[model samples]
Target: MKIDGSALIAARQKLRANFPGRGEIGSPSIGTQEWLAEQAHVSIRALQYLERGEGSLSNLKKVCTALGISQWQQLIINYGEDYVSCIANRFVDFRPSIYPPENPETFANSSLLMTLDPLTLLVAKGKFETILLQEVNATLTGLAEPITYTWLAEVSLTPNGQGWLGWVKEVEPMNLLANDVPMNVPIMFKQLCVPQVSWGAFVDAVENLTTSQLNIEVCLIFQNFTKKFKVYVSVDLLKILFNEGRNKYLSPLPYRAQLKAIV
Candidate 1:
C-alpha cells in the first residue's frame, strides 16, 4: 500500500508534540537528528529523509523501535491537534460514521449480523489469519458450538488421500482460550468442517455463521477438494480482534511445525 503523505507528516508532528519547550530545535533531551541517526545506525542523510517521511520501511521500523513507539498511529495521535484532526478527517472520509439521525435507515439494520462464506472468510483472514481463527473460535465457544477448524489450505497442503482433508478431531482449544479462564471448565466446541468436504454446502454454512449471532453447537470438519482456492481478509477486522484479546488461534501447532520444517 502507498504510504499516506499527509498522515506521515501528521505522525511526525505528533511525535514531536510533547518535546520540551514545544520541540525547541536545540533541546538536548529531545535528541538531535544526528544523535538519532547514530543511535539508529542510519546515515545522517537517511535520518533527514525519514524525518521528511521519505524513508524506507526498514529505516522507519528501526527509528520507530529506537524511539520506543508502535507504528505511525502513535505518532499521529501524539502530535499536535493538527495531526489528530488530519487523521480524523481522513478516516471520516475513508469510513464515514453513520449516526442514527443522519443515517436512520442504515441504523435500522445496524444490529443485523453479516455472514461470510469461505472465500469471504479467507479474504477477511488475509494478513490476520490468526485473528480470524480466534474470532471463529470465540464465536463457537460463545454460541456453544461443538467444533473448531484450522484450514489446511493455509498451510499449503493439497487435498488427497487423507492429506489436507484429514481433520484434527477434538483439537484442543486449550491454547485458544484466555489464560484467565479456568482450564478445568468444559470447553465448548464448534463442529470443525472444511468447505471442500461439501464445497457447495460449506459456502452456504459460512454465510449463515457470518449473518446471525445465534447460539448453536455443531461439529467442525475440514476437507480439501480443490488445488487452487485462495481467500483474503480485511486488515481492520484483524486489528480490532487483536486489540480485543482474540489474537490467539492465528496459527496452530501443525501449521507452525509445517512452517518450521519448510524453513
Candidate 2:
C-alpha cells in the first residue's frame, strides 16, 4: 500500500506549528521529530520512512495518534475515494436510535435540559434521530489523562432547503442507560459540553458533501482541551443512520416541506 508522504509531512508540520511547547506523557517539545517519535513510540528511522511514504500502515496510525490526527484516513491523499470507501465500510459502524433516552429521569439533574427542547420537538415530530459512536478515546494535547469520550450525536434536517443541523452532547454511561447499559461499556462518566460552532459546521458539511467524500469532520469536545481538534467520520455511517431513522419513524402530518425549530 502506497502512502502520501507529502500529506503526512503537512499534517505533522501543522501539528508542530499548532503546539510548540513540551508535550505530555514525559515527551519533549512538540516541534522536534524525536519528540513526535517518542510520543508515537515509533523509531526515528520508521518516522523518517513514513515521511518518505515508505512505512507500514501500522506505523502511519501511530504517527497519526502522536500528531493528534484522529483519523489516519485523512493522511491518505493518493488513495482514491474507493480506498476510503472500502476502509469506511469495513471499520465504521453507526448505532442510531431516538433521543431523550427512554429513562428521562436519569438526566433530570443534568444542566442541559433547557437546550433539549429543540431535540425533543424533532423526535416528537419524527424528525430527529441520534447516532452513538459508542466509545471514542481522546486526550488533551497538554493533559496527562486520556479520556474516553462518548457522544450522542443529535441530527435533524432543516426543512428540505435549509440544510441539516446537529449537536454532539456528552453522555455519562451510568446515567445514560444505567439499567441496561453494561458496566464494561466505554462511555465516559464526565460530561463535556460541545461547542455549537463546532458541531454546527460538521452537519452542515454532511448536508453539502457527496457520498464520494466518505469522511466528515467531527469535533472532540473536552472540557480542559484548549486546542480544538477533529475526528473524521465516515459519511456512509451517517447515511446508514439517516436511512434507518427515516424508515423507523412515521409522521402523522402530511409531509410538509418546511420544518422549524421550537425556539
Candidate 3:
C-alpha cells in the first residue's frame, strides 16, 4: 500500500498532538524539526520529505517509531483492495466515555462507522504522557442480544491510574476488518503479568476457554506517546485477526506502550 499525502499530514498532526505544552492541549517539548530529525536518525530535509509523504519506507518507519505511532497504518492510506471506500452507518457507541474527545473528529477513524472495525487506533493525547492503542474488535452491543465478554489485561499507567482493557474469547472467527494484513496479525503487546497471544488463538482459544467473559485493565503507554480513546468491545462478535500467516505481525505496529489514561 502507498502512503498518501493526507496520511502524512495526519501523522504529523497526530505526532504534534502528542507533544506537551501549557494551557489548551499542552506544550511542545519535542522541539524543532532538527530535533525530530535527530530523534529519528534522519536529516532535516529527510524528515521534511517524510512529513510530506515523499520519503523512503525506512524513513517513514523511523519517523513513525520516534513519534510513538502504535498504529502506523494510520499514516498510510491504502491497503490494496481492502480500503473502506464508503463509510458504513455509525453503528457503535461506547458508554461511560472510554476517553476524552479531541481534535473534533478530523480523521476517518473519527467517523463512527470507520472506527467500527477492529483496526489499529493511533491514540496520543498529552506531551510526556502515554500513547495507548488497541485493535478495536468493535461490535454493536445491542444489535440483537446482550453478550458478556471475558476481559483480558487491565493495568494502570498514570499515577491517578486508569487502566487500558480488552476482552478475549473463542468462537467461529470473523473479520473485524476487511483488509487482510491488518486483520490477522498476531496482535499482542509486552506486559509484565499477562502472557502475549496471537489474534489467531481464536482458532484454538475459542475452544480452549470454557466461557466468554473476563476483564482486566492494563497500562498502554510507557513514556510519552498519546492519550486514549474511549471504546467498548462486544463479546457477541468473536473475530479472528487478518493475515496471521502472511506477516509476522511485529514489523509494522509497536510492541512497547503504556497507559496514559483510561477508565
Candidate 4:
C-alpha cells in the first residue's frame, strides 16, 4: 500500500509534539546532530537535512549508525502514526540491501522477510491466515533450530488443494480424521511424519506451505496462536518474531531463566 501524505504530516506533527520546548522536531539529545555528523564524516548540513527529513537514504543510514542505532525501524516508530502503517508494511516485506556494506546476510533468513508483506495486507484487510509461511521458510532454510517432531496421524482432503486438506496432504502418509470416531469397519492408517515441530516449527510449516496461497489471513492465525501459547515456545524465537513486526511482543525479563537453561 502507498504511504499516505496526510499520515506523513501527522507523523511529523507527532514528532514535534514529543518535544514542544525544543523549537524543532529532532532527536532529543542536544548537539546529537552535530555529533552524528562528525562521527559519520558528513557535513553538518547533511545531518541537519536528515533531522528535518530531507536527507537521502545514505545519509540517514550513516547518521543512524553514528548514533548506534542498528535498524531504522526504531526511528520510524518514534515518528508515530503516519509512519506506523508504512513501517508495518515495510517490516512485512523487508529484504535488506546486499549492496549496503553493513547489511548482514543472516537477515535474509529472518521472519521479517515473510511477516512484513502479509502483515501489511492483514492491516489493510483486517483478516489473515493463522499461519505465516516465511517463518516456515526460515526454519526449512536451517536458520533456527526445530522445536518438536510428531507423526502425521491422518488426511482426507484433495491432494495439493488449499485449506486444512492441503496442509494434511503436504505431510501425507498420515490420516486426518474429522474426529476420533471409528468407522463401521476398522480403517487402515498410514504413518505420515513431520520433524522439528515446535511452536516455531508449526508456524514455519504453515507459513512456508501457504504464504502465496494464504497471505495476511495466515498472519492473523499466527498472531493469535503466539499470544495464546507464549509460554510454550522459546523466548528467543518470540523475540525474533516480535522484532520482525517492529513491536516488542515478549518480556525480556521473564525469559532470562529459560535462556539460561538453553545456553
Q: lDDT: which candidate is best?
A: 2
Candidate no. 2 TM-score: 0.28
Please, what is the TM-score per model?
0.25, 0.28, 0.28, 0.21
- Angstrom error at residue 158, model 3: 46
Give the per-residue lDDT digits (tens) of candidate 4, residues 1-263: 11122322343345445545433344433334444456777897876555555656576666566655453332331222221121122212212212112323333322221211111211221122122211211112222333221212123223353432222332222211223232221111121123312222334443344222222211111211211111112334434553443333232111111111110
Report per-prediction Cα RMSD to one decimal: 20.6, 18.1, 20.3, 22.4
Scored against the true structure, residue 111 in model 3 reaches a CA lDDT of: 13
Which regions in candidate 4 have their CA more than 4 angstroms from the true location?
A: 1-31, 73-263
Which regions of candidate 1 deviate over 4 angstroms? 1-12, 21-35, 51-53, 69-263
TM-score of model 4 vs. true structure: 0.21
**Native-to-model Cα distance after best TM-score fit, residue 142 in candidate 1, in Å:** 46
For candidate 3, what is the TM-score? 0.28
lDDT of 3 by residue, 1-263 (tens): 34544544565566567774422333224644655677788897887766665667788788778767655654453322222222212222121112212321221122111112222322222221222232222222222222222212222222443422232331222223332222211122221213323222222332244444322222222111222234433332322221221244332211112211111
User: Candidates 2 and 4: which is better by TM-score?
Assistant: 2
Q: Which ten residues in a row have the lowest lDDT in candidate 1?
A: 85-94
lDDT for each of the candidates?
Answer: 0.30, 0.39, 0.35, 0.30
| Candidate 3 Cα deviation (angstroms), residue 197 | 53
Please give the clash total of every predicted structure, in order. Answer: 34, 0, 39, 26
